[model samples]
Target: MAQKTVLFKHLEQPEIHRLDVYRDAGGYGALRTAVNDLAPAEVTQMVKDSGLRGRGGAGFPTGMKWSFLPKEYDTSYLVCNADESEPGAFKDRELMERNPHQLIEGCLLAAYAIRARHAFIYVRGEYLAIKELLDAAIEQARQAGLVGERIFGKDWGCEVSVYRGAGAYICGEESAMLDSLEGFRGFPRLRPPFPAVRGLYGKPTVVNNVETLANVPHIVANGAEWFKSTGTEKSPGTKICSISGPVNRPGNYELEMGTPFRYLLEDCAGGMAGGKSLKAYIPGGASAPMLPGDCQDVGIDFESYPAAGSTMGSASFILFPEDCCIVFAQLRISEFFSHESCGKCTPCREGSRWLRQMVERIEEGGGREEDLPILLDVTDNMVGKCFCALGDFATSNIVASIRHFRHEYEQHIRERRCPFRPHPAAEPLLQIAGVA
Candidate 1:
């Protein structure tokens, strides 16, 4: 574990969230350097040179995203996506709650680099506590002249605002988040006129995830080469892997990119819980296809998992025990996507419903042999057919479940019940003495 701590090192220090404590610890020095010495282009180029990618699942290049703004734009915005709504992903929330100024300073550095005066942190409404923590951090920064006007007594200044959204899973999508921030219903907007070109009040905007922005200050303070020295060439710096499910030490572990999943499972998480052997695991969140547990040697980076036919999205690993029912597990996922569908696209709105119904029926022992192909066909139609990835996300579980655990599904149908999971106890029966 040669991974040097970029985000987690100082988290335990008391009052680390305070602007004063953070500044004394040499925080915001990157923002100061950018404001005092570096030009906007230089800062942007530095991030570009560092090879920072979005940590919010997509793995898109951060520098290129900032560079997308037109050369001359009067108005632009920088949105820090703090809506950590994905199940098994709580990295952003933890970052903001513990070391808030780091995220704030990162946002300001990015705002300066992009030449955007206004930055907004669109946090999930459920994270009211985190929102307030950020709010206080912003005010503290403002009072100290780090935000508001003339940051660091320089001509350039960036103001950061914390905006909360109704808890919509769809809002985690950048476009939908834009719509929600703009006071519209949280629905995903169509692309082609991508947010970088025309976004947030019809102006150029750059939306970076909480963890992505939090990395900015570190990259600025430490040279790109220094940052690059930690992780793989493509994925530089450590990644906070949010480990969940039945692991003995189920929590967040910051590991260098390219660290094998086996290390995380055995060394960090202390292996599976209750002495249960691994059955299957979601390499990413629910949106990623589940990989059989035997693939533990797969590296936790942008490339490795996909090479193994699964995504390393957000690195939200959810493991399953051998005794777990694959059919029932997928049923819950289907139900969630069905309920959270934004209803913006027909394939997603309708396809998700159909998948959930069929999966529910199959899990409940009402499925026919023919239902499997029908389910696959439904997911086939749903994948990449929706306005957003939500539609495509809904398909990963079912498709991967059958691909890897088809035997389990077959058992469910053959036995007319979930073999791994115990069924409800039979109703108690009593007979009257006279009747007997």
Candidate 2:
């Protein structure tokens, strides 16, 4: 069943990004209520009660993250992870483009809860237009006293700024994002002092995704019970799923958490395009293990995915059609991870590159029978040994492909060619790689 839109309720409104249109639709009302009536701890408790989790890949509890700040810190910072560079993740981009104020309001409320004096949004350089939109929104909010000194005439004050990243996928990680924001190269930091303990110039910090923060205003405006009433208890509220790859209607669809995977593909996304049958799908972008087509019975939420031997990483679904070549797909995904590896850790830096080479050789019809075990071995080595999740992401698709479709790899080795034809768009690349 299609649940009513919460975060995307006002998405269709023209000029919704503008403060006037947004305010008319109850934007910033939550921040005002939070500031005027509720204490910072009270607001944090409300979010915890709402069961709101981070929409970022990790699915960490948002309120719990806020609560991690030291009670007596001199300075605390809130950083918004706006780097939507995951291969198929565009939900954050759309949310920021359509409902800028909602995110600003979320940031303000979050900062208030953490007692953060300043907040920075680390946006990817590729999202130039989104930066412009958010910058304008921030300026407008400052002028209207929705941001900056004594917001809503309350004694509390918080400033929000937009910092554009240099287009590194690793920056999406909280520690790397802080590094980039601090004018350093994007690289994951050691975890002895997590961001909650020490971040953004040695101050306690809270990092949240764009979509995750965007949900804050709604949770505050409506009561926590109302917010929790929709999705499952553990994964309450609607999720903005970005569906792509061979779907008839590939775009962002806001559905309640725990909605079945079948509902997303068939009902919301209009099923596979061009009369194609589903083969497999990445339940949550390229970093998540792909689920077989028959796993449609699985629910699209945090708890459900892990139970189904997959994950709900960013809720970016990339579907594979019947004619799609799993080996070729894995090769492409491996290449992406390889190119994006920050080289900060030997496991991710070297393992991802080696994985890409192995996948490329197999995809180009140079596979040896020993390659499969080597691939799995490489993936296992990189899984828990990397400095950050990027290394784990590099192995997700490759490992899942081997688990579900090992025969595909065997066929490539046996026949000395890709059993499936390359897509027309990939034909040039395959030819260039000497894959006849």
Candidate 3:
């Protein structure tokens, strides 16, 4: 079956980012219907029925997250996570840049459902262009009475604001984001006081991904059943996948949840670059466990990925060509986590650094046979002991690479060099290690 485009339907239109262009394409009609006709509870129920899950790393059900908010909070907030800092993830950037109004409408609908008077989009600092576009869109909506004051002349009103983060990957986590939004250093808070309970100034808050919230207007404009009709029963609605790394065509492509990975790589991404054969691919973002290239038959959905020993995290498909070294790839990933760790927990802050060192040693041909076991041991210690998922994310690529390509690490030790490709610096590193 051909991939269906939901969020990107009108994305190709050059001026679709403008307010008038968006309105002509039937924008804000859903917000009008939601505000004028449907009750707040009804909107929540509709989203629940749609079976929409978070497009963020954790595939938690979106409606379920909203339902966790207290029914009698004095004030509540809807936070849109626009931090597209995850390596190989850029779908949210495209959505916010091209269809800022769509996201605003989605935020409006979500705010209405949760009865939140104020909504904040915590966009990463790097997305300055997107922030400018969203600022213009929000101002446009405010002037037209679509946002702020009596929206569309209805009783309910919502004030949408944009907050910029200091480019911390940990801020992508909900509690950490709340801490950042509250003018504190970005660090993950302990659970039991989840964001739904106490978030954004100790008031109940609902934090959702940009793509997850972008589906709200469609669900409101059409119906729950309409939204559910597209994707699988468990993972409904279209997902915008950000394809990157060594592909002939690297860009964002929106498709139904159950579409095969083969279609995405071959038809959508135009296959691998330089006629290279497949080696390995990160099924989701860099956080997700990497899968062998032959797993292309695996369906691109939440349930399907885990069954195949991977995850559909953020749907950021990072394809690695055959020439790419897995150990070097993991070393780079480890370096990212090490640099991004908030130092909130000892295991993550220290373990991430150690993991990077281990991978670097292995890549530099200084690894001993015991280094593989040591890497696995360090990953095990870091997985559940950290404050947030960052530690676990740091482990994913290392654990998955070691599991699937243990021989790659072993060959590096036995041959005292990377067998696949010559590392010019490997000789110098081995000389420093007093090997060979």
Candidate 4:
């Protein structure tokens, strides 16, 4: 595996986040080098060359996103979508809290590359303290002429402002973020005018994920080839793998993309909590479909993950031990998606609730074999019938589960009982369990 880039670099340093400490550790030096030496186009080209995609859920290419901007437009903007509300995804939060300047530096470099005169970091409301830290970092950068006015004594100049979102998951979508930033409602707009050409304030804009922007400084500091040396040939660079659920050491593991799941679980995260045998895994957060234990050997990269039948969405690796009930865990995840759905689309808004209800019924030993087809029918109705990706995302687990674990679902329906009922956490529900 290639070097762990952002997370491991200044991790051990007690004062790594401090302005003086970060500066000494070759932190914002990349920004200085970028502004002084590289042209904006060259920087964008370099990022493209490096094969950096959006660290956000959607794996859109970063430079391609920047290149989508209309060249003749006068007032293009860049906004870092820090409104990370994905279930089981917390990499952005760690980056914001522990390494604000790294993100800030990336934002500045992206702003310069896009020729954005103004930029905004749209942070979620829950990250209040992190926002303050980022603001302070921005101020520090501004005072040093890294932000605001003619930065680094160059003809090009830009300013960055941090805006807080009103705790909406939908705002994580780029267009919705732009809307929220403009002090409007947070519903997703129709996307023919994708954020690249027509974005914030009806001008060209580029919105990037927090972790995606955080990669910029290092990519610029080291050449694109250096960044490409790590990870898979297609998906380069180290990604922060958030390994949670039943793992003994459930935390972020920033490793190269093609790192083995066993290495990530055993060596990096100290294996499962009780040395239990591994069950299924939701490779990239709850949104991505579950992978059976047999596929554990698959490399954790864009190409490999999809080849194993899942997308690399935000690198939120959630593992389940062999003893854990897939039905219960899936039901819980469905409930979460049902709760978080923005209700913009009918399929997601209503279908998620229905799906959760069915799962709940099955979990409580109150389902029938007939319900299996019904569940599939319900899931079938949701596919490609929602407003945003969130709708489809909400249904991915149920679809994948039935495809792989139909017997488990059938066991719930056939005997009106969960085959693996050793959990004992369902006493309350079983007390009132009845089939509908």
Candidate achieving the largest lDDT: 2
Q: Which residue pairs show backbone clashes in model 3?
A: none
Q: Model 3: per-residue lDDT, tens digit, 1-436? A: 4489889987668688889999999999999998989999889999999999999878899888899998788899999999977887889998988889999999999999999999999999898888888999999999999989788777789999999898888889989999899898988999978889998899999999999999999999999999999988898888888887667788889989999899999999899877887888887777899999899998889999999999999988877667667787777788888998999899999999999998888888899989988999999999989878899999999999998888888988888877767643323322221111
lDDT of each: 0.86, 0.88, 0.87, 0.82
TM-score of each: 0.95, 0.96, 0.96, 0.93
Candidate 2 structure quality by residue, lDDT tens digits, 149-254: 9988888899999999888889998899988888889889999699989999999999999888999998899989998999988898999998887777888999
Better of 1 and 3 by lDDT: 3
Task: Report the Cα lDDT for candidate 3.
Answer: 0.87
**What is the lDDT for 26 in model 4?**
91
**Angstrom error at residue 141, model 1:** 0.8
Model 2: lowest-lDDT 10 consecutive positions? 427-436
Better of 1 and 4 by lDDT: 1
- Per-residue lDDT over 232-303 for candidate 1, one digit per residue giving the tens place of the 0 to 100 score: 888888899988776778777889999999999999899987798888888788889999989989888998
Error of 4 at 271 (Å): 0.9
- Cα lDDT tens digits, model 4, 234-319, are 88888888777666677777888898777887888787676677768887877899888778677877888888888878888777
Per-candidate clashes come to 0, 0, 0, 1
On TM-score, the leading prediction is 2
